[model samples]
Target: MNTFGLVIGLITLAVIGIGAFWVIRGERVLGYLWWPYFIGAGVLLMVTSGFIKNDWCSALAGVIGASLVWGATEFKEQAIRAELGWYPFGNHKKRPPFAKIIQKWKPPNL
Candidate 1:
């Protein structure tokens, strides 16, 4: 019933879609830590939802928060793609220092 939640969810989906497109095209503009940052922001938003006065506002906040948490997972998958050489490692010929940790967890063929 809350239109605001619907709007926020749609916008979140669009942003996630664009991010996925960028990753699929080998663009790593957001970097590895973006996921954790997004997840943190999402958690903050969800916590703020508890204090919101309007029902629609709270719903919107919660929806956006969930979407951001999901986005964080997508970011990790993007990192995996980058490690597998399916995606470029941004501006570096070598993986960035942040990627070194992820590289250690990469599977042999992937």
Candidate 2:
């Protein structure tokens, strides 16, 4: 019986749960402007995972990367939720570099 698939699925599930928390917390602390950075890092991790030889390591990296990507997309929605009083809103969010430029671009949605 191959338990590899089961283990990977569980890990992915856990990452997804964590993703939700981070999306809320991250948007509050870091702001939605950080979405581009999250997507970049997630894609970097996913591409790096291809070079990993160990099956478990590679799978874990890929799962985490995917979660980050998903979380990036959620940042915009999370920000809206915060504005709507659904979540805690932070008055001082850390802005990313090139804030002016990033503000001109629309954030990606799922």
Candidate 3:
């Protein structure tokens, strides 16, 4: 069980690294490449169900599965933003709620 958990953790790390690299490369992987993450999460869930006797394994599996889903979402958001030409972190007029926060941190140029 411990070895299984370790393997899952390593796989999760690999997914994260690959996802991040794609993002950095500006390849727009997020818009259409989300299914592998779904498969990973589904597998984890299916495996965890059989690990009921090992509470620790079950819990770790759930957490790892959820994290993979979240990672896919992150990639998807970036992809959609790229497709739409929307750069959330890029230059833009500050909106209402954030405007006030920005004003507080204004530099000399502002």
Worst 10 residues of 1 by lDDT: 101-110
Instruction: Please provide, for model 2 over 1-110, each residue's C-alpha lDDT reduced to its tens digit, 9 standing for 90 to 100.
Output: 99999989998999999999999999999999999899999999999999999999998999899889999999998999999999999899998999899999999998
How high is the lDDT of residue 72 in model 1?
A: 64
From the highest TM-score down, the ranking of the candidates is 2, 1, 3
Give the C-alpha lDDT of model 1.
Answer: 0.64
For each predicted model, how many residue pairs clash, with residues at least 3 apart or on different chains?
0, 0, 0
lDDT of 3: 0.51
Query: After superposition, which runs of candidate 2 have C-alpha atoms over 4 Å from their true positions?
Result: none
> What are the clashing pairs of model 2?
none
Q: Each model's C-alpha lDDT?
A: 0.64, 0.94, 0.51
Q: TM per model?
A: 0.55, 0.98, 0.36
Cα miss at 24, model 3 (Å)?
6.5
* Alpha-carbon runs more than 4 Å astray in model 3: 1-32, 36-50, 80-110
Best prediction by TM-score: 2
lDDT of 2 at 78: 93
Which of the two candidates, 1 or 2, achieves a greater TM-score against the reference? 2
> How would you order the candidates by lDDT, starting with the best?
2, 1, 3
Clashes of 2: 0
